[model samples]
Target: MNIRGKLIIIGGAVDKGSFTETDLDKNVSNNLNFFEAGILRRVLVEAKHQEKSRIEVITTASKIPREIGPEYIKALNYLGATNVDVLHIERREQATDPEVLERLKAADVVMFTGGDQLRLTSILGGSLFHDILLDKYQNEDFIYAGTSAGAAAASNNMIYQGSSHEALLKGEVKITSGLGLIDGVIIDTHFVQRGRIGRLFQSVVGNPRTLGIGLGEDTGLLITNNSRMEAIGSGLVILVDGRQIKDTNLTEIELGQPISVNNFAVHVLSKFDTYDLKTHKMHIQSSQYI
Candidate 1:
């Protein structure tokens, strides 16, 4: 299926804001500042209507929707986004609300804030809202963007549970079905800051056919035409390729035991780097400072 839409999978920022000015700046040295930096602004610019686009920020994954939702609105509003609103769909019933469906239908970009990826998959999966989102992403020039846990749930396969420390142990990294927007890929956020490389490694080694994407803080990928991804923001994007793995003990290793995988290919991508999803290729351009 040829997709006509785009995906912006962000590495997340300081989204657990308690409604303070420090909410977005608490981890500025390690987090993506959507307004001052490029991720959120890029989301607006990618929209067909720019700041006028009807953007819906989904807070289904956030426990404190009251805090996270308005903060996003405040940030986008600062960027001159006129029609942005927060959709605090905490209950499953809200997934089928006519008003929610209407707003979704009229939206140019849907942004998913960080929280619990499992909460998002459990509540919205198979709902009419999810149906429309999938259809729009496949048929229209729509945008589906997510950050942190939202980024993890953007793919068909999601990693909901896994400790960064024990991720390499067999049976440690848990996997589940996601929103199914993109196939054959798994996305992990706060890669560098959280040291989640082991989690991603265990994930891809278990399912070598799937591509593992580790997004660093203050970084993201602007995936256009559904296949070409341009690394955006100010950090690194790690591409873990398990397609060439020569051997792995994941299939035979006992629970809590270490697993081994050989021939795994990894790529470290920085800003201005491009990767072809369809061909599994990475293209790095000359450094701007060089």
Candidate 2:
């Protein structure tokens, strides 16, 4: 029961944009080569390693028909996954079942689809399902990956408060409990498109205790086996540092006020770029971000 593996969160925008052969090659160049060469095969190459055969899709927040559709399921099967279990977690009866936990324990990649993140929190909050989610992260047989709201909830601190246009002013945001698979930071998804710079600031200003991370659509951050994180996908992963802020004039902020936020620096990166969470330093690594 070796439970150590990297966690990769792909923000909403999966299967979107110009992810053609050329684009995928350009974007995931090294990873594509690995896939072609069966390099990723070793990650779960053996029958013993192949026991990770389940997928728990939390459709609690978004309608399954709308979020992922049918083609996505077929894609998983095409990838040679023997079992693909769809859990309609929104239904109260299913939500309360203990069997749900067992299914989660058997999953290889536990994917969360995009929807209202607030809805995700409201439904799974304080439930057995939430506990099982945390347990899976601790388990040796699972991998956690979320997109959109799913990506947002992976952080220790959840920024469920404030809108994209609001001021970064003080007390404008709220932090709620997430699954807590990863700690010491907050995640905000749909970063660039939603223009959520202010919201991240509001989150930090409200909490002032954790780091803030805003990931753009179609982009992902993979925390590798070496304990270093690399940005992947089409867009940039935004890192906001608030460790140096002395004070924020959020109290003086109005509804919008252009959402001015100080004491926060933003870092954007493409694939092959790495950022160390332990040392709080950003660097480019020799290794490719596959």
Candidate 3:
């Protein structure tokens, strides 16, 4: 698949506090603050249309849309974004609203906030708004960004319900169709913080052909042209590649029984590390400034 736009998949807990404060600072230099130098800041710069960027923030995934909406607007505004509008489409009926579509049409960057992944797909699936969003993602010079639940819903296959501790058991992980912005991949957020590696592993094993991407909080994966991904942020990004698996007991086990597999490859990457999805290989480099 050839994707023309860029994807900024964040791992949730992006700085929404004081831009000048150092509370959220992880690996950032003293000269660079967290809010102005965090993952979201990198996303804004990568959009490359910041000066004239008309950002449309979709808060449908958030349970507290009103609260999350303004927070993003404030953060973006602090980052020098002049025109950031919050599209509070909470219902399926609101997704096809003319005013909503109009704003989406003119947006240079479309951001989805964190909440429930199911809410986003259920509300916008098969709607005119979704079709337009997918079209823009494939053909326009657009930037598609999502954090947490938003990030999990960006792939063709999404893990809706699952517990990491019970992930090794058959049928423990539940998956459904996502927005299909990117193909052959499944994404999970707040990975390390939430101890979600087992669930991500289950996802990759079930759909062995699909790559699994686990993102840590405050970290992000910048996917360009649907092929290469570059890690950005203070946390780590874990990749589970099951293409080389030699054996598995998935078929023989019952729905609740544990599964066994061998030869599954795992890769851990940090900031500035790059991975080629097509080749299933990674290139790691040490941080230059650190």
Q: List the lowest-lDDT window of 10 residues for candidate 2.
A: 34-43
- Which residue pairs in candidate 2 have backbone atoms (N, alpha carbon, C) closer than 3 angstroms, thus clashing? 3-140, 12-148, 169-250, 170-250
Candidate 3 residue lDDT tens string, 153-265: 99999989998889888999999999999999999999999999989888998878999999999898999999999998889999999999999998888999998989888
Native-vs-model 2 lDDT? Answer: 0.65
Query: How far does residue 257 in candidate 1 sit from its true spot (Å)?
Result: 0.3
lDDT of each: 0.88, 0.65, 0.87
State the lDDT of candidate 2 residue by residue for 1-290, as single tens digits: 23364566765666432233454444433433323223122223322345355655556657663445343454444446566656667755565687886776566666677787778877777678777776656655466667888878876678777766553544556678876777777888888888887777777765566777778876777764324677876677888777777776666666545444456766777766888877878886554663
Error of 1 at 148 (Å): 0.8
Residue by residue across 190-269, what tens digits does model 1's lDDT show? Answer: 99999999999999988888989999987899988768999988789999999999988887868999989899999999
TM-score of 3: 0.92
C-alpha positional error of residue 264 in candidate 3 after TM-score superposition, expressed in Å: 0.8
TM-score of candidate 2 on Cα atoms, chains taken together: 0.77
TM-score of 1: 0.92
Ranking by lDDT: 1, 3, 2
Give stretches of model 2 more than 4 Å off.
Answer: 1-5, 16-52, 65-69, 169-174, 224-227, 251-261, 286-290
Error of 3 at 65 (Å): 0.5
